[model samples]
Target: MDRGHVDAPEGLLRIEDCLDADGNVVLPAGVTLISLIDRNIANVGDTVAYRYLDYSRSAQPAVFELTWTQLGERLRAIAAHVQRSAARGDRVAILAPQGLDYITGFFAAIKAGTIAVPLFAPELPGHAERLDTALGDSQPALVLTTAAAADSVRGFLAKLPSARQPRLLVIDDIPDSSGADFVETVVDVDDVSHLQYTSGSTRPPAGVEITHRAVGTNLIQMILSIDLLDRNTHGVSWLPLYHDMGLSMIGFPTVYGGHSTLLSPTAFIRRPQRWIRALSDASRDGHVITAAPNFAYEWTAARGVPDAGDDIDLSNVVMIIGSEPVSADAITTFSEAFAPHGLPPTAFKPSYGIAEATLFVATIAPTAQPTVIRLDREQLAQGIAQEAGEGADAVTQVSCGQVARSLWAVIADPATGGELPDGRIGEIWLHGNNVGRGYWGQPQESRRVFGAKLTHRRSEGSHAVGVPADGVWLRTGDLGFYRGGELYVAGRLADIVVLDGRTLYPHDIEQTAADSSSLVRRGYVAAFTVPANQMPGATTQDTTEQLVVIAERAAGTSRSDPATAIAAIRSAVFRRHGVEAADVRLLPAGGIPRTTSGKLARRACRAEYLSDALRLR
Candidate 1:
């Protein structure tokens, strides 16, 4: 395997430059994650590697701390145990919560030369279906979890068929052993590292086959893009370990030789202030860097500033917002609410990424403020991003940022498979080493999604420009446009609804409805399109598709007057999006389906609605 080297553009620091006078690269190229951990132990053994906290236990919220030396020893011991049953290339499922144990088990799987499948613990109701499906798909040789979750994991696994059952191992019960005697295994850069499962928002979840090369390259891209090298960077996160964002945060900091603090997702949700407080504390030492989805910023902003008088300091913090649609209003609200607490507007970094691209594709420059544009709604419906004056016809969009210097992006017409001009909304196509190999056990899908090529064609007053015929591009399935050298994501191609020859994005309609009524639950609404024939009060001549919205009602809200709620939703959709929903279903809280990453499962919700399975009021 080749230890790929990145040719950093002028004025940018190179990864190899982070070496000593002896020309020893701090993080050697082609090195596995285990090697990174060992190097950290050798260099900074006494430094804290991870700190896990559980706010549920008010008496003792601080759970545990692991130093570099201790973490290396623990992971090696777990690796030895795993190697006894699993061989190189075998899959090992990790059904653990967000804690130090999950991190140890995951790295240990890598050290044991087995593919790690990180999954959510079966503590939540209705998560068994998802767990069972993942187990049947991956067919792991063994499962690893913490002592606290081992019983729940076993109970869920008992219901599975005998053929699909996997051996269970508890990390906390593993006896301590000297890892120095353990034999180290060789792992190649091109070898499979793990299977990152998709969110399954629009379809059934499939495993994305990610290689060590992709992981290493993406980490380099992110580190360089954010200019974290030689900087005082402290990592903090509240995202679940199962998601790509969370996994990258934990793993990337280790590779960078930095300390990270983690908190449970439930704790963060229960008290958003804890996340802010963690950042404030970390800022006392150095600049704090953390990442979360867009909804987290909204949730924290909604909590309002505490009355404790400017106790929090966000001046030395860089908050990355990604993993979902970037809301301009959310960014504005968060910045304004925290400004009194010393939060700078430029600290909020809006980014764009996906599981297929390993993790990060692009992020705004650290010194620049995030770009938010208001475009004409009518022009946007026609696949153009013309600027609109201040009025109700303007649609606000936040730019994900410029493409990483190591990667390339092109906007392509989905229908024609040809590249589109800048500022035109179309499918996003990416090309870079960070892109994953393909989906696991899915040859057809891999080829179609990862091996896409551009088709050259001539049009009026334009000559055909041929792209390299041998180069393969990753079809991102996301619709966006380029403006001023930055990417602005419009919406997903699969979630676009067409009505009366006009294109409408579900996010726009859902946002409008959520803001229309206080009773409707924010971020819990889903919008999709159904055939005109399937909707009542529509004639056969109505060739246009009908809009359908299913929104969850806030808890403790009265459902006795469904008619009024339905009318309000309809009015909001028409007033904002210029289209009326053919049907509006107001369901109780938790009625709408969401993926493990907290993304709206529009396709699943649509399926349930069509089957009359949704609990409608």
Candidate 2:
């Protein structure tokens, strides 16, 4: 297989070979992000990567994101300690919220070349079981956590086997003579970077192994996509770092002369306008780049663009839309709402990617105006992306852009494993340097995903060096089509709801309600199958499938008045998805279980629903 190279139209993406036909890139035994940042800081002294309003200090303080030199000092301290304490290559677990400390601890683990396992930071209503399962699956030797979060996971650890228990390494600022290993600073990237566990609802959370080389490659891909490194653009982000986007999306952009504004999803969801205000209030004069899922835009559209407290302009903001499937209406709604504040319609960059692909595979270039197609909703919901034109009630399909300059995207028949043609909805497959190594330790499933490689048109001749062996591809579980050199997403093949010969993706239905009138207005609603038998080990949401909607009221609106919200959502779902909601419950804003990185935890939300958590008070 040929190692592919990125040849972006702009001179921004020049590369010196980006492929390894041998299927393995030689990497140091146990590298970490600490090493990378440390090297950068040591080499380039006094370069700021983050600046923020220290509410406690009540002034803008320039936090050192990295100055190569400072990074070296910190990582050196942490790496030396970890390397000295290797007990059969002990795994270190990070069970803390997002902060500088979290980043440091993670980098320390990487510098030690120790496997870093990140537990989802969100409070899963019934996550103890999942956490216990993950702990057992990874069988870590040590765990690093904050005080409060450590308190929460303490009891959960007791449920594990005595021989398999992990040694707790807490990063305590408020110390009480607790005798746990405390990581002060991470120093290297030659270690196993991290083991990001998938959110396990239907299946167990698989750990995806990452290395220093892999992480570096992924970060470079992100920089090229957004041009953050070129001409020195700045970034403002609210994405959580635990997920791929948080790790790569915001941080990588901030690595080279780019600054980042960090906020938790809960923070942004609580005040949809904060994201806008972040961009408007930036002190720097560079193209502001950032990203959020479709729901974020819907939330802003619902809350109504906040009055720019200080003549805030978002026209220069290049907001990337990805994570979940991108919806045309949600982007349009947000673009129109914030347009008055100088929010450019082109700034709504609709793109496609996932965690398996390291959070970014393709993006609608830095200045390329977001291209959207109006398509037939009925046809689309049924796996046919017949394009429609500008009109009332027409479904807007946004292009996710072509494959990332370093990545390859292919639409294939789910059953036949054969590549499909443009405009024909099928499973979206990916292959490239950006593709992550298979899930950690779960070799069987990993082979099923990353190991099952495939060839594309580019692989036919000289490009054949990189085509996956055995006609395999990254099973995106997403349904989409290619047209006019751009990608238009239909729905997720994995989450499709096939009813009475008609097909629909749960996200599509959710997007419709999120985009349309205020029924769901800035809220969360989902549809899942509830089997008629509710039998143990029952798979698929078919035959016994039921739509369950869990939503948060708009900001400032109390959940106590959920009657109106529920009614609106119920009516909208019925009208659009043709699937009646089994029940609609209004949860407090931010109540929905989300991924560590702030993605709506639909399965977790569904679990809450089935347990009467979706009921009105």
What C-alpha lDDT values do all the predictions have?
A: 0.80, 0.61
How far residue 455's Cα lies from its native spot in candidate 2, in Å, is 9.0
Candidate 2 — what's its lDDT?
0.61
Tens-digit lDDT string for candidate 1 (268-319): 8888888888888888777788997767887888863555764887877888
Model 2 residue 138 lDDT?
81
TM-score against truth, every candidate: 0.91, 0.80
Query: Which ten contiguous residues of candidate 1 have the minimum total lDDT?
Result: 457-466
Instruction: Write down the lDDT that model 1 would get.
Output: 0.80
Q: State in Å the error of residue 259, model 2.
A: 4.5
Q: Which ranges in model 1 have alpha carbons more than 4 Å from their true place? A: 1-14, 17-29, 178-181, 390-392, 457-469, 532-544, 554-556, 559-562
